[model samples]
Target: MTGSELKKLLEDSPEECHKLLMKEYGRYVYAIVYNKLRCCGSREDVEECFSDIFAEIFIDFEYREAYKGDIKNYIGTVSKHKAIDFCRRLNTVKGRSVYTEEEDIRQLASDFNVDERVDSSELRRILLDKIDELGEPDSTILIQKFYYDMSSNEIAKNVSMTASSVRSRCSRAMEKLRVKLAAAGITR
Candidate 1:
């Protein structure tokens, strides 16, 4: 069914809507969660993430406003994020040491310029400012793909886009960053 029809169904008969949504998007959501959690999580984690996605959709989704685009996309995005969160928690519990805030700051600090005259901290600040300027999904995509070392498929899952779309956006965003850096006389 269409998004509008699903919205009406959700409003009119939530239980039936839940069933229909599950029937329609179960595999899609499973794929997203499974793909994200497969490397670091267990089968139970995947199952939990799947169930949580549906539960969140049933309990929290504002069908009319939030699902204006496509329900499948919404579900996929939710599944991806939930799986990622689960993986993070699992990693912490397993003492895997996923990148922490302190590590991020240290990494930024260590990313010094070749010219000792230019303060490394200042350059890091400028770079962050430029990245922020890229705005919204572009900045977010770039950070997730490069900084977080996420794969294109993983990034796509998080952003509710296809892998190809994420790659294209990442390429475009990198080009923009390169141009911005060049303008700032920081070309490599």
Candidate 2:
């Protein structure tokens, strides 16, 4: 459905809008939650996160201002953020260290000076498109390794590859991504 139609439904009949929104975005929301929490959380946790996302968007009425842009994109952004938040809370409740050494290293690596000429959102879109172009296991490995902060062994278990193989493929994928990003003029 179009953004205008959805917005009108939201304003006119919130209950029906809520149902339609869930029907449309449920899988997308679940995917984001699963990717973020698969390593540390159960299926129930993902479901809870998905429900929380819908509750935050619909019941809290945050989507009122989101009608200007693509509703799916807005929902995806909210899903990602909510899933990350759920992961953090899960770690805290489990008494695990939320911040790890790998996370520190990743943060240090990402602390490069921002280019004033490139808008952050635009750069992010470019990078995401580039990553998608990488295809299959490479894209999945990079996301799991960097974004989700999964170790090679953990990733290996999930992907059904050896730990050493996961590391090797991850290294290769990083090089490929670096080249792709450089070609796109998104240098670090």
Candidate 3:
């Protein structure tokens, strides 16, 4: 609803207007308050800020007269300001920041890049290709021993080799795979 519609409702019955406003903007108020207070305040702090916003709206005659925008915008503005006030009260350091140097601004800017997304399917395909490149018994030994969680004795029996050979092959195969992955830019 617009501010005018709410104003008209307020004239008829204050109680009804209150209920209608709550029904219309409860979640909207919660979202605005939560967005501001989530980092610095508790859930009760957010709830308190939410209630304070509505109370201010109901009591402030000047706000009712002066605000001419959509009800959501007014509620949003009230909730955001209330939440910020709540934060300032709760955390002394959060609401005030002094960027003394250009380096401090650069530090904040360095953290602003968009996240790089990885393609899992292509990565998996590359992994499988690299595993294939490690020929025969070494590949078989690595898969069964690592992927299948088989003991060296069991892998030795399966691959027709001694347990010591299976153990050595598994170690050497892992180093080779590590080197291959590093070369492909998939580093530790």
What lDDT does candidate 2 reach at residue 83? Answer: 92
lDDT of each: 0.80, 0.80, 0.77
* lDDT for position 110 in model 1: 92
Write the residue-wise lDDT of candidate 2 on 1-188 in tens digits: 76678778888888898889887777557668888999889878988888899889885554455475467877889899999999999998999984469878889778865674368768866876787688877777777787667799988987899999989988888888899999988789
RMSD each, Å: 11.5, 8.8, 19.7
State the number of backbone clashes in model 2. Answer: 0
For candidate 1, give the lDDT of residue 87.
87
- Candidates in order, TM-scores: namely 0.49, 0.52, 0.51
Q: Kindly state the number of residue pairs that clash in model 1.
A: 0
The superposed Cα distance between candidate 3 and the true structure at residue 26, in angstroms, equals: 0.9
lDDT of 3 at 15: 88
RMSD in Å for model 3: 19.7
- Model 3 lowest lDDT segment of ten: 112-121
List, residue by residue over 87-183, the lDDT tens digit for candidate 3: 8887875555544688888887887654422466467657767876898788778766755467999999988999999999889998999999999
Candidate 2 displacement at residue 11 in angstroms: 3.2
Compute the lDDT of residue 95 as modeled in candidate 3.
55
Which parts of model 1 are misplaced by more than 4 Å?
A: 62-64, 98-188
